[model samples]
Target: MNAHAATDTAASSTTALPLKEQLVLVTGGARGLGAAISAAFLDAGAKVVVNYRSSSQAAEELAAAFPGQALALQADVRDAAGLKDLAAAAAEHFGRPITTLVNNALVDFSFNADARSKADELSAEELTAQFAGSVLAPVAAIQAVLPSMRQAGFGRIVNIGTNLFQHPVVPYHDYTATKAALLSLTRTFADDLGPEGINVNMVSGGLLRTTDASAATPEEVFDLIASGTPLRRVTSPAELADAVLFFASPLSRGVTGQNLIVDGGLVKG
Candidate 1:
């Protein structure tokens, strides 16, 4: 999933376009893993629209690093109308339709097991917020981009998910449940959109070594998780970002509805 590997390749399928020729809209592409994803696409020569709800300064800085190739636009992914405006602004600025999307926006949450609400303690409000970010926002994002993708007959949608649904080692009730729902939507979207030449997929990761959200995780816990994995190391944001490129690139044109885990062999699927 190196930049050159994705950039040097020819078209992978009849409708699959090269990475350099694509314009990508990345939701919450301002910081943490989102920033890494944005950087990966930019490095692969793709024009990127880095959408941020708040982190305006960080978003602007990331766009500044890429000059004309990246634009930091503000939009709340939870709002469909806002997302539509985001898509329009991106296409207007880039002068090309956005053929790729990375749904990596995350609601405020920490990975500290002790801090997470237990099943019995989880509130309806917590579940609702998670659902808005995980399931509803993605639906809105897809709707926002579907028109252009339909017009071009090409699209790549990558949903950011977590492996907790499969292993549930910590059982983050609200967060894990919504992400599992997202995985289901990923498959259904793939089936519904495949005929139109669009690929919808998910990239699930275990607790990353250190993202802003996971910064609260204990150091010993990271060491323990790493030791359990065959790779004997926690996955980095850059490493997971590379896996995302696989789905967004022509490499995965024939693939859809699959959740590829990028947690250094922690959960083999």
Candidate 2:
């Protein structure tokens, strides 16, 4: 969505606190799609805690821009202890439990054709690493935050997914498999947490342009994607941010355990 459209929505939602007093933790919030998501939450007046592994400078800069409203934290999702520490720090800083958790981290985004490996060629370590970031880490974060959310009786957990998992444009076997597993986790968590007033959902989108993650994508690949999509254009991180906000906001209170595809009709199934 364009800035003007987002501003309109924000204006409409201004009657409430605009997630201002709400504590939110967004993983991989240093750059790319994560950065856009963080910015969206910030614009909505949410108290954002941005988690990053190596992008410390970027994270700190983003947080500094928002002053007291943002906190840049360093935590590697692969490290369970580190994840717990970050979660604890976020809770401590907010002086209240986090009400929203956005699991937007990922590893092994390599799209090299020559690097493709089938099941037989894939190593156990590779599979484990992929799943650790895409699935296990999110699960751990959810576990860490569930008690607080349950106590407060309100929560929103959003898992970032990819449209490529459904379309298979490229054979990112390990990445696709792990993301598919995360989608399943989203539904399962939603079903398990619904009674507690917590909602779990997934947002899947096609190749998003202007993000660091998609910088490696060839121009021809994007051309092909735009031609194939009904919107005749690649999705943008800002556009996907709207879908994420919908899930986090009161607008989608009943939308749990669902995968909302924002690929501009690239994968209608």
Candidate 3:
């Protein structure tokens, strides 16, 4: 489906504020797609914790726009203890356990093919770093939230991923490999947490039209991607952000361990 149509579908499918009385913690929620995701939940009348590792100014600025509905905090997701502190801080700030967790924090990796290391040239350290940042970070955050989720018998965990794995038009080895592992973790978590009323899922996006990271990509590349998609345009961070809301809402209470690809039909789910 086209981006607009997909959004309409999501809006109709959403349950609004199934967790209206609870809090949401979005890792890397300061900028890029993370910003949109945080805003979406806030617009739905949910309080949010916008977590950032370094973008303090940007994070605070964004949080200011929402006032009491949102707050910005800093934590490196790669640190398990740090994730614990983040969850504690967020619960203290909102006076509630976080009912939703979005693992949107990303490691420092570039989409520039020339700068990316090929399989043969990629270092063990590079792969390990990506894993720690992407996979282990979410694992830590999930672990941190499990106690509360179990207590309440409710939770939502959305892991942001790339649709590149579905369409490997670009050889982003390290980034894609880490996301693949994360996808696996998403399903496993879903299975393990289903009985406890926790849902784990993934929202994968293709080349976003323009984001801080994709800004470096050539315009010609964006046009090429747009032309190939059925929508004849690249997906926007806003659209992907809306898609991420699905799993968090009660509309998706019955859905888990699923990957929804939002790439303008360039890559089918």
Candidate 4:
């Protein structure tokens, strides 16, 4: 293991950094876990920029709920120009650098095993498509924000991942492999950016009960997963979002380049 993982929480202590003191950016934040994370940040007193690829109405409504504290930005994470425009808009709207970023805008993928491409049948195109969302987009977003984060002398970046990478009970090959790549990038970013006062980390969750993606999942599958977990229930988007807040808060300032699995203890990392 890299020493960066051990050093991530070397500064962790009781209490938390003030959320109101931070400017935050959340990708794909219009709905689902993204919305939950955005709401949590707003409640914490931070100014937020909610980025979405489509779902304009939902984004508008979410931003409206927070009034002046939040703004809805339409940007496809895979587009460099859009990501840059988003950062610029956020800075202008909030009058400060974005101090925190949550890479939650997931590429379209069904969680159903039947719907997924098996390793034997999966193609290079499938892997590349997943990578576009899982890894490439994150790299673009980080590049878009790095100068501002460094200038501010503080930063917090949280990447959304899946517990499937740790335990591929169903082996969603393309999805899990992309996330595994992302996990590696998380640690790499933490290693490179830690000294610059930026903290990079990942929060991986198990199958969310009823997100749009998982709504296709069979009830029996949910039941089976729930029965297997110690908590006797799969995680909810809202519940997992709360855990994400910890990474953005000062409470985890010493933590970085590490993956926090929030899967009801189903698969202990």
Reference-based TM-score of each model? 0.94, 0.90, 0.92, 0.93
Off by over 4 Å in 1: 1-13
Those runs of model 2 whose alpha carbons end farther than 4 Å from true positions after fitting are 1-18, 118-120
Give the Cα error of residue 207 in candidate 1, in Å: 0.8
Find the candidate with the highest TM-score and give its number: 1
Candidate 2 weakest ten by summed lDDT: 10-19
Candidate 4: residue 45 lDDT (0-100):
87
Off by over 4 Å in 3: 1-19
Give RMSD to native, each candidate: 5.1, 6.9, 6.9, 5.0
How many pairs of residues collide in each model? 0, 2, 0, 3
Ranking by TM-score: 1, 4, 3, 2
The candidate with the higher lDDT, 1 or 3, is: 1
Across residues 1-269, which tens digit of lDDT does each residue of candidate 1 receive?
88877754533454678899999999999999999999999999999999999999999999999999999999999999999999998888887888999999997888999998887888999999999989999999999999878876799999999999889999589999999999999999999999888999999999997888999999999999999999999999999999999998877878999999999998877
Query: Which structure is stronger by lDDT: 1 or 4?
Result: 1
Better of 1 and 2 by lDDT: 1
lDDT values, one for every candidate: 0.92, 0.85, 0.85, 0.87
Better of 1 and 2 by TM-score: 1
Inter-residue clash pairs, candidate 1: none
